[model samples]
Target: MARLELKSVRKSFGSTAVIHGIDLVVEDGSFTVFVGPSGCGKSTLLRMIAGLEEVSSGEVHLDGIRCDHLLPSARGMAMVFQSYALYPHMNIHENLRFGLVCQKTPKAEIEPRIQRAAEILQISHLLDRKPSQLSGGQSQRVAIGRAIVKQPKAFLFDEPLSNLDAELRVKMRGEIVALHQRLKATMVYVTHDQVEAMTMADTIVVLRNGRIEQVGSPAELYARPVNQFVAGFLGSPQMNMLAGLGLQSSEDRFSVSADGGRLRLQLARRAEATTGDLRCTLGIRPEHLALSERGALRVTVTGREFLGSETIVSGTLQSGESIRASLRGAVEVALGESVAFEMDLDHLHVFDQDGAALDEVDNALPVDSRQDEVRQASPHHR
Candidate 1:
């Protein structure tokens, strides 16, 4: 196993600096994912780590040894790219053994390695076929199998599933997890998909503009995101952000007001909120809103989507803000109908104008209990 660390890592092309000084560590045998949107420098950073791109400054260290200046082949790492990139002319068996041939590995050892990789990827029967005959998913598997044959200390995958269809991607996700368990090798995966990051990573690095936003387990980032960007970026359907809302402090808890002190909802005390009026923004996830006759706000249903086990309702709130409510199982609601929705006080998240959370333990029940309640409702990576 290898522990990868980048200290003050910076990359620049000409005078344009793409990667800001970055400091990160990937522990031995852990799966770490770098995730963000396009132009976020995720792929550039990955290439830098792979030694495919020259670093302008700082150092890349693996297992306590500096290797920023080493060639890609000298680094004990294997990479799987978005394209399968197989030698189309070669059969699967020959393609799988090509790397070993280039390295001048013994003929006896090459066949065993090929056999092992094909068996592990369950592509033994297809070994005699060419890449042209394989499906997209199967071709990608062959590509991954090539990396597996290398048996490197660490594996780097750059959007390896982007080419596959949704169902194939899901199947490959499970396969990658199983492979990780079987080998327990260190892995650094890059993707623009939060769902992939949430599902695959032991540690997630959320990056933007070549800088690291937050690094944490899926549960930590999901439960207590450091800022608004992270809170919005990590969730599906996104978090409902009440941008023009005002805050009113009660004796114990706080209430959110719209249109100058109109009670929209009561909120749990923030662990960092004060007694005075604060310029406040509120965030409530779609899954946190419950449909109720006694709901605090009524929304005009604009659309409804029934997704097997759950239903999502999109509507316009009384404040003229868009809101979506996700309820477990099916929901009985119609378009153009008025529906009432409520959020548990404990589930309300208060953000300041700068997009930071507030509520300094305005002490009602022990804040830990409510925090635990938040934890209970939170979806954690298994």
Candidate 2:
């Protein structure tokens, strides 16, 4: 295992910069995921580290050695690409041994390496089969086995499961995680899928336009995003954003008012930011809202989607903003019927004028207080 580091790394295409100066450290034996939308420079960054792309103006180091100028093979890394990149005419055993053979490794050493990798990946029985003869998952295992035979310092995966069906993707994800635990190998994976990043990464590096947005554990990024972009980008079904103006402010609390409702929020501990009459965005995850007998906001249901264990209701708020709420139980509300909904104050998120998150939003209020405030202030309750 080896620690990987990028210091002030950058890339450009002529006058247009693709990757801004960025720094990151992937700890020894840790699974680090670089995730972002396309054109965000994630794959480009990965290629640079693999020595497939030249560094425009930065340093890449592996185990304390400057390796940016080294060849891909000399850098001691193995890469598994999205396409599998298999030799169609070669059997699984030959494919797995090809790299070692090309390096003129002794013939006596090649067979054992291939057999060991095949067993580890559970593809030993299919060693005689060609790439065209294997299933998608089986082919992926062969590709991974090929990397394993190299026994490099680190594994670099570029969307290695993007071609599989949803079920196979889930199965492969677990298998990969298991493989990591068994080998304890350092890994750097690149993907555009947030789900893949969330599920597999020990540390996630969220990227935007070739720049780092945030780096944290899955829970940290999901529960406390540093900006609106991170919050909106990381969640499924996305976060619901509402516009309102701050009405009251105090050291520990604040209130905001919209067209037909108001919200009271507790500030995060040590939160000393200014508050008063400022236009801010209110962010709430779909699962953080619920139907209530009394709430400051009322919405008319427009649609509903049943997602097995939960139901998602789409509606227009009194202010005409569309929002989605996830309910644990079945929802049978008719279209156009008004339903009262309450926000869980402890689960609320606030964003500044420029969409940056304020550091002092509190989420420690008692659940009873939150429900009480909604019940007491709502017109429907009175």
Estimate the TM-score of every prediction: 0.90, 0.92
> Which residue runs of candidate 2 sit more than 4 Å off their true CA positions?
259-273, 363-382
TM-score, candidate number 2 = 0.92
- Model 2: per-residue Cα lDDT over 1-382, one tens digit each: 4999999999998999999999999999999999999989999999999999989999999999999999998999999999989999999888998999987879898989898888889999999998999999999999999899988899999999999999999999999999999889999999999999999999999999999999999999999999999999998888999886666676666665554454444454333443666677888899988887676457778998888788888989768899988888676777887887777777788787788887746553422334554443221210
Worst window of 10 by summed lDDT in candidate 2: 373-382
Best by TM-score: 2
Best by lDDT: 2
Local distance difference test scores for all models: 0.82, 0.85
Clashing pairs in 1: 270-359, 270-360, 270-361, 271-359, 271-360, 271-361, 272-359, 272-360, 273-359, 273-360
Per-residue lDDT, model 1, residue 259, is 25
| Candidate 2, position 353, lDDT | 78
Backbone clashes, candidate 1: 10
